[model samples]
Target: MTNPRADRVRDVAKLAQRSARTRRGLFLAEGPQAVREALRLDARLADDGAPRLVAEVYASAACLERYPELDALARATGALRTATDDVLAAMADTVSPQGILAVCRQLDVTLAEVLSRGPRLVAVLCRVQDPGNAGTILRAADSAGADAVVFTEGSVDPYNPKTVRSTAGSLFHVPFVIGADPAELAQQLRGAGVGVLAADGYGPVDLDALQDESAARRLTVGPPVVGPLGDGTLGDRALGGGANGEAAPEGRSSGEGEAAPSYALEAPTAWLFGNEAQGLSDAELALADARVAVPLYGEAESLNVGTAATVCLYASARAQRRGQRTG
Candidate 1:
């Protein structure tokens, strides 16, 4: 492992290529920040009955000394190995290595598995091509307490190196799905009692309006029956996310209320954000229960998709958290 030209270094370096990543079913997480998160999550996810994501950790002596957590994790998992600085640099995609990197299996879960948790908030990146945008959105989703993120077909690969770097370890914090069908995913979410909202600059529904309405409705008595937004996609009369269609407060309900309080953003929600340049197609927008727009107050033309997603996801997260406490 000391030699930079070793076969292990070459193979690990090859992961920068998508083809190589796909062939090997593994991706490289460069730098200590990314690698540390992977190690932490590997054990945490396992506790939740999900497979461990981190398979191996290669680090320079400096990194292990600088971060004792890494040393402890390696001792526990038996996956840590010391490497020369040159070896780490060879395995990293960045010009300056962070003294460590991780080899982790691509962490993807089935759509059914994700929905079975009855997630309160979710983000769907539809046809977003930029790796940086995708990674930033993942970070935003994690920060907003989104349960999971979905990368629809034509969206950037969730495991891309640039995307991983931009995530700053949030990638390991939140679960994500790749290559999902936008239409099918929408239908599935609707079926699970989650409302699907599409993010569009020209969307008819104002995000602020939805928040105001949600706040105003917090004290209502009857559980709101969620229906289709006349988009001809989801059926009417469906209750928002809950166990067995009953109002479960969190993913698991404790019989807190007879019926769940429903708000536009309080209900189990999946937000669809389109490509950075073209935005969502007509059909893509139509798949949502409603199309929501973040109103721009400044003279700026439009917000970038990453920024828009952050605003939208946080709005939903705030509403959902408040609803949970109230319930």
Candidate 2:
């Protein structure tokens, strides 16, 4: 494996392209961290009698000595191969592959499979174009304990080299569904008892206010009851009503007669984060039960999608955990 011009090197290098990756159903995971995670997942799946994820591993001798755990995990896959630094670089997407790389099978699951698992928190990326942003959001979702991450049809491919690198190995730790339709996905999430929320800069609902209400409910005298909108009297206030318990702000109310949709921060929720430039489309926002905006006290115009998502997901995670404890 010392020759960088070998056919095997070229084959592995081709995975950097989306077309090649799709054709082979394989992608390259470069660097010690990414490859180690891939091999670890492969080992876990294998232990569970599931299909293995790592198809092959190419590592330099120095890498194996530097990270003995990677060497052990790679050998456990029964697909480890020794290669020179030149060969490793030739087969990797990164300028410096960090002495190791692995070829892994795409691990995306179906939308039905994800819903069937009864996920409590999910992140939906709607037409997010940047690979780095998508990866960062996925990493945030993983850190926030989200059940899964969903990428809509127009979103950037999660298997892209830049995205895989941007994830920093979090890609292997989370379950994700690809190519979901926004409208249909929303309906499905609702059907599964999951509330759909859109992250919009101009949204009427204040995220902080929702958190405060959630905390108050949890600490109240009575046990918290969870159900659909209009099931209880918390609708108006939870949506966007003022502190005095009057009607919500103009254009923010549900209607004159009907109660506003209930969006308890503790309930099962799937958040929709839109593109870096355009944000969520009007149609996409309409798919959500409510649109929530991350408040800014400072002079910043808006928060990045990744940062906003971290805030929203962590909010849900905290509320959900508190609900579990208090219920």
Candidate 3:
């Protein structure tokens, strides 16, 4: 019934590309748990029963021997493709193909979805190209209890195979959103009452200065947003942007509000982090209502983007939890 590219990596990639993987722009997850996540998203969740999964059913004996369980899981999950192992192998992406793979649809989310969620915190990533960094940032967003992870125009794709692997399981739990135009995201955040903040490698105010006291937050930055992109929204300040998009204050922003105010976590807030090496540009810095920086000790220069993002997100979470208990 199939072209039967069994035991072939190229064919596997191709078949998968043309099948659900392409229609939904998703990739194959090799591990059992990974497939389970896909099933969960599709409403095939079973807390204790044998988890249904997706896989090529008519595999060669060798392929079946390699991943016998995948067949059962596929049948359970209703993702079975009755094709020879050769065909299945043709459509996969692994070097030494794992007999099991689950198809996932890439999330096509927008900024407006983030606004409607009623979030209290958000994280924004800007031009963080490293897939590892992108994945770590997503994990941090979940750990920090962010409502959403937002990406800017030039950030790395969260669905990039390496990136998906890097996220571990956090990839499935987060509500991510992607936006092509920074200006459009800005308008959405404003309407949602999310105040955007920029992270500076050497800004005047401390990172702890971003705790807020109002509506839910929204964040934006990077290319494809990841994590909880629910009530909050996130975005990046144009790298090298100036105060009001001018100069001088480009490294940071000085405006009407108190430059370094810290509030409860329940206070709505969105925080933006910049590129890996170059940091946020002047124009980008100008876009934020305020600029935040990690309180450095030695002469280390600066923290890695992932490290900085984690710290900021965790801080917001901590404050928010504290507020919840107190309130």
Candidate 4:
């Protein structure tokens, strides 16, 4: 533990690479926050008769003293190793590991496993290549109390060191499924009674209007108010208008003698967030039941994927929880 160049230090450092992590079925959780969360999850899983998540933990004496809880949790895993600052740095992915790091088993669950949970809200990342954006979205999903976050096949590796660091310990807090095929995943989610929505800037449905409609439903007593579209439902008004309240372009109007697709905001839902640059592809967008756009009131051209995702997920969270309370 004292030697910075020891084989054990090098082995843990190898987790910084995707190939090594894949081969060993482990990833590095750097910094005190990440390490602490990992240890806590390990303990929880152990209580369920599950295998330990933390294969090993390396910490400097100062770090253990600074965070006694971390020391206790790490020791509970029976994998804690006291190491010099130099050795701890050698084993970490960050420039500074915040005095501690843990080698945790890959925590991704199968798509079937996630679906079995009857999740009310889920976030799906499609071809998102940025580590920071992916991690931030996962963190946002966790904050919104999303049931799970799914990473499409082409999305960035959720286990990447930068991505793990960006989560700020949220990686341990949220359930995630990786390498899912967008089309198949969409089908499965819908089959599970979950509505799949794509977050597109040019989407026909305005997210704000959906929130308003949800709020209105919650405030109503007997029957819902009949909008001008005359379906006795707000779906047409909410879906047939653009973010600016303008009528949807030709062929996209839900008010034209057709049943407006009923996408109740309070329903079980999964949101698909696309890549930072190109956004959702046509095929990917097609997998969703509806495309939703987050409104931008200011001069800002667009919202970052993370910010947009936060808005969308929290929207669903609020609507779902409120619906539950009322029901």
Best by TM-score: 2
**Sort order, TM-score high to low:** 2, 4, 1, 3
Q: Give the TM-score of candidate 4.
A: 0.89
Worst 10 residues of 2 by lDDT: 238-247
What is candidate 2's lDDT per residue for 187-268, written digit by digit as tens?
A: 9998998988888765555677678878888878875555334333333332322221112333344223434444688989
* lDDT score of residue 143 within candidate 1: 96
Give the Cα error of residue 192 in candidate 3, in Å. Answer: 0.9
Per-residue error (Å), model 3, residue 136: 1.1
lDDT for model 1:
0.77
- Report, for all candidates in order, the number of backbone clashes: 0, 0, 58, 0
Task: List model 1 lDDT by residue over 1-327, tens digit each.
Answer: 699999988999999999999998999898878887888888887789887788888988888899898778765667888999999888888899889888999987888889899887899998999999999999999999999999999998888899999999999888788889988998898888888887765544557667876677678877752543343321122212211111111122122232212236777889888887678887797787765656655445567788878998999889887777777
Window of ten residues with lowest summed lDDT in model 1: 241-250
**lDDT tens per residue, model 3, 1-327:** 356533334433643343544554656554445554555555443554533333333334454455555445556655455545455455545555444455555664677777799767877777778888888989889777788888787888776666666676577777888644555665567567666666764454444333332222333222322122322122232122222111122344433233343333445677777777666776667666656555554444456678878877787677666655544
Query: Each model's C-alpha lDDT?
Result: 0.77, 0.83, 0.58, 0.81
In model 2, residue pairs whose N, Cα or C atoms come closer than 3 Å (at least 3 residues apart or on different chains), thus clashing, are none
RMSD of each: 9.6, 5.1, 9.1, 4.7
Better of 2 and 4 by TM-score: 2
TM-score of each: 0.85, 0.90, 0.68, 0.89
